[model samples]
Target: MVRWWRRPWIVPFAAIVVIFLAFSIPPYLSFDPARSRVPQPPSLGVAHFWLLVPHVLFGSVALGTAVLQIWPRFRRRHPAAHRRIGRVYVFGGVLPAGLCALTIGAYTPYGPSTRASDVVLALLWLGVTAAGWRAARHCRFGEHRRWMIRSFALTASIITNRIWAAVFVIALSPQLDTTFHGDEGLLSWVASSAAAWLGWTLPLLAAQWWLERDHLRTRRVHSRPSASPTPEPALPHP
Candidate 1:
């Protein structure tokens, strides 16, 4: 059986992430006040837009680099390149985007649930990446790899969040008038917040399950008793 890490789906998964990032990020680049996705705080005014730009741009950088970072073939063939891209993913992509997410999440018009989820997600992303970097610096490569798998899981959760949000909205549409009282705005926040909770949390749980599966397999191998050495037969020449 093929190893899970070497499965054919990994590359295709990364490509889909890149494609989604491309489709989602362009509207922010227009820089028109009318097009801002983030709700600017009354005091912050246009400052939110400034933050959103780098957040999206660096996020794209991080998302793109993370694809390379996670590619087993890339790491095996170009260790130095992998290290360089890791730096970019950390310093450029996740660092800025995670920071901006802290503020943006709090300001989300959706509801408290979404705000809560986003803040928590941002914190975990940064914390996981930091742990991964520390592990690498200390030469604990195994631990580093595990932590980075987690960080990428968090990084990719945004894509999942978008998908969940759309799914919830569509699924709830039938109740727009009967249940939501025909308040489109009300339904929007309800779905958005619900999606926010499921998106990152579910993916992170799956990542943990994946990591534990590998760890358990390793332990199982090590726990097996070694075969006893057999005595050699007396030489016929004797």
Candidate 2:
């Protein structure tokens, strides 16, 4: 069912489940205080909690909205409803994710290596969301499609993370007696993290670019007229 995957909500819902499972893993749940090299401010705990709550809440809402976004009948029949859901998706999903990105240190499980990617991830989330929203507002349908595709790509990182982790552990199982061998485990984590970023986002961006290429070309052509230049006045017939 390739068609099923095209359904907006299906992919997003799947992403949510994948993310939930990834975070539930023991590695993520057990926070290591010593791992955090970044110094905390007085409000670090409060900020962390606040950031975390919204990420979960908005992420769920975004999944729901994605389903609505893909329903052809709903989009055609009730454009206003679609717009409303879109607004919710933006405010709920993208905004908090961006904020959390800014507070990258709060999520680092083990110092710089863990948190190093946070800035890029956060910026990607916000950039996609903002671009999508702006494109929709301007009625740039092609741009809108591209931006939304990119945004969802980033959202799918959660799923990618788990997939990478599973694959890494399986491939290296023979070499390491245990999955938690010190250097190997760290390397595994790094590899999985990198895969998570590339696996989901890059493909989506490529697909969006390919799909919208013609549309963008059409827009550009229409934007410029092919009218022949009027011959300059014959210098008042000299």
Candidate 3:
């Protein structure tokens, strides 16, 4: 299974499909947008709205950047373009995502447990974004790569959320009558939301760790050299 997914096309194709579904499907869902009635203050001022607009616009760009980073041909041919797009992705993708993390805490439909989980996830998302930005600024290519992997994993949570929601609805539908009966609607909503949060983020983090293990090991080896034994002094007696 691991070997199969390692094929260059598999990840990019999956990422493309996931990004498409993430932007397209949420509007149609009954629970989205409308559930949060009491609006929080916008983090960015009105003038910054244009900057925030790219968050929605360039989600596909973020996914495409991930593909370019992995694909050798694209990386070599347009290194400058890749760097420019990466800047766009970090600023455009991560900055707004961090803001949404702050606002989303108030809007969580589930109880405190889920809201708290979201808070942690949001912090993790922002932390990884900052780390990635710092790595790039320092010209640490390996660090930059690993940090971006983690960042993109968090970003892909949007995709995972929907996939989990669909699965939850299918799995829990039959049980609705027996356990929840009339209250099944509420139960399903809570379950789906919770599943969406964990299902997407956790596996992605795990995958990032796995993929970057060798790079991380190489870094550690290069960082510390073995102490060389002192050369023996020439024997004066000879």
Clash counts for the predictions, in order: 0, 1, 0
Q: Give per-residue CA lDDT, model 3, range 165-209, as digits (tens).
A: 677777777777676775864775667566757765676768677
Candidates arranged by TM-score, highest first: 1, 3, 2
TM-scores for every predicted model: 0.91, 0.63, 0.67
lDDT rank order:
1, 2, 3
lDDT against the true structure, each candidate:
0.87, 0.64, 0.63
| Residue pairs with clashing backbones, model 3 | none
93, model 2: CA deviation in Å? Answer: 1.6
Judge candidate 3 at residue 219 and give its lDDT.
Answer: 88
Q: What ranges in model 2 sit over 4 Å off?
A: 1-50, 105-107, 110-114, 177-188, 212-238
How much lDDT does candidate 1 score? 0.87
**Which one wins by TM-score: 2 or 3?**
3
Better of 1 and 2 by TM-score: 1
lDDT of 2 by residue, 1-238 (tens): 2455466666566566656645543332334433332333455654554455455456656655666675666677899998998898889767875676567534654345446555667777788889999999999986887788777666656556557657866776665645456576466556556655565556566667766786788899999979898887666555
Model 1 residue 56 distance off true place after TM-score fit, in angstroms: 1.0
Cα RMSD for candidates in order:
2.6, 8.7, 7.2
Local error of candidate 3 at residue 169 (angstroms): 1.4
